[model samples]
Target: MTTELDLGSIRHAPKVLLHDHLDGGLRPDTVLELAERAGYRELPADEPVALADWFRTAAHSGSLERYLQPFAHTVAVMQTAEALHRVAYECVRDLAADAVVYAEVRFAPELHLAAGLTLPQVVEAVLAGFAAGQQDAAAAGTPIVVRTLVTAMRHAARSLDIAELAIDYRDRGVCGFDIAGAEAGHPPTRHLDAFEHIREYNGHSTIHAGEAFGLPSIHEALAFCGADRLGHGVRIVDDITEAADGGQRLGRLAALVRDNRVPLELCPSSNVQTGAVPSFAEHPFDLLARLRFRVTVNTDNRLMSDTSMSREMLRLVETFGYGWADLQRFTINAMKSAFYPFDQRLALIDDVIKPRYAVLIGG
Candidate 1:
């Protein structure tokens, strides 16, 4: 079991990230460098600091337009094999610095075809980048491990192709399949064929459902497609009903989630910005957590959200007045839900996370 945190010594904490997006986490400096290299100048700001502020402001619009602008720039730079590898490598380097023990990052290789790179080439470049990033992070004494999730654009019709690519690279570092993009009209069932392939092949998957949409989308992702984990699952609250007293009413769907222990990758700030939760106090984070849902906090789109794991944790601490115990509970939830091998996951818990936390809480 994990213990309370001292906050003074958070560097040794074994953090885990499950809902990060590769195209959404570029460093401002790197964004500029890649933008210049790609000969694309859609950025509103020429400097790194201004560029970051610009991204934060755009993302704050809480509209699809704000969410889609930065990606246009990121995807533009990532068209080439070299640029893709470089961005992937730098992402891991940044995560390691943040003391991330394990991270599962996803990107859609199908979108990089504008520069004429094959799907396999895109996957290969990202793998090489992860390998290099791990080595570089280790040398810097901030060791981290990263796994890949190959995503298919939901509005587009490349799910089958991307699913095949993900399976091809599974042993090479790719962990699973995912469907991303605007979820309002393009439901997860639209890519059921690809989901069926992964299901038939025994490949694990987590879908981006119930984020921009509601419980109907999440229902299809799990019931119709058999999602291993839900990306946000924030809207599952639609099925929950609180009573006048301290007791609560568990709707059938909410009961299924609780009984099965599906992980809700809850990013409080991002969810609010995305209109999933409306506001922090009204957010279902405390509600879901108190109901014993397998809830974990995350930074879904760090660049757009202008967030990190530490920042998210600090926000929860501020909002709910959470102590070390709550933070550990959230961290354990993340560890249990990570897409890593069981033995390595246990080893991390026993060796790294448990020890540092024990020292913090004086166990």
Candidate 2:
């Protein structure tokens, strides 16, 4: 095995990201420019550096609602089709620079309809942007592939509409469907009809569960709504307990998740900032990884958490002593759990992920 990795080395390592929100990952300067172009006048700060800090501070306000308050500004600037295209293009470009070979970025189309653009227009704009970004990344020699996950806000009632939209564009660029928003009063079961429609079309889904809420939400997402993956399922640790002699006990729900090998899109920094867990040292990621659950590292919101895939992996490496082998395992796990086809996933692991790690580990 190779020695412990550092941030500079980690940044050069190939990565796969599965859980990033579009509205939550914009560059600070891009947000300022978009707001200015759209004549949005309520920005908390005019400068990019201050606006970036404002997002992080607002998200660290110790409440989920407070954490989400900054999105209103980001979404406000992303209403027009041109703005959507630029935001998506910049997302792929940034990820490529970070050495992310594969990613699935998510966004709620319904949220971008305020400026008279139809649902189809929003998806097409983002897809076109992804295409342009992918081409540019290829030309720059950091080639990356990106897919979209059409999301519907759970607090709203447009899940079925979004689910159908996801299927409509599945062959174009959309790869899956998801439900996001406040989870306290809005459970996954409330959108059972949407999940059912996706299942009927044999489509894939990941639900935001067990983050702000408890295990009941997770149960409904998996057993009830049939989610293929869990978004921010960090709270699954609630079902696991340590015994007197350091042995651990897994409750039924935890056992089921582990047994099924259900993918948990765990966002470390975002979880801490949103108060999903107490701190990084007490984060359940290490525990879940040791238990051999299908845990994947992710950046739920890059802007809010001020993170990238490299930063997230660096934090875990420092906290858990993860080496090159551990980093490779996490990358492969994310590739396997991707909504992309199995043949494509296998090719990436064999041709890209493995080869890249082999170089880093000095094979």
Best by TM-score: 2
lDDT tens string, model 1, 1-363?
334443534545668889898999999899899889888878789999998888887777675435666678778889998998999999999889888888999999998989899999999999999999999999988888899999998989989999988788889999989998888889999898999999888898999888888889889988999998998888899998878896888888889888999888787877877666668788889889988999998888888888888888877877888866677778878888887789988888788777766665664
Candidate 2 lDDT (Cα, 0 to 1): 0.94
Clashes in predicted model 2: 0
- TM-score of every prediction relative to native: 0.95, 0.98
Clashes of each: 0, 0
Candidate 2, residue 258: Cα displacement in angstroms equals: 0.6
| Residue 253 accuracy (lDDT) in model 1 | 82
Summarize candidate 2's per-residue lDDT along 220-261 as a digit string, tens digits.
999989999999899899999997889999999999999999
RMSD of each: 2.1, 1.1
| Angstrom error at residue 183, model 2 | 0.4
Error (Å) of candidate 1 at residue 111 is 1.4
Q: How close is candidate 2 to the true structure, as a TM-score?
A: 0.98
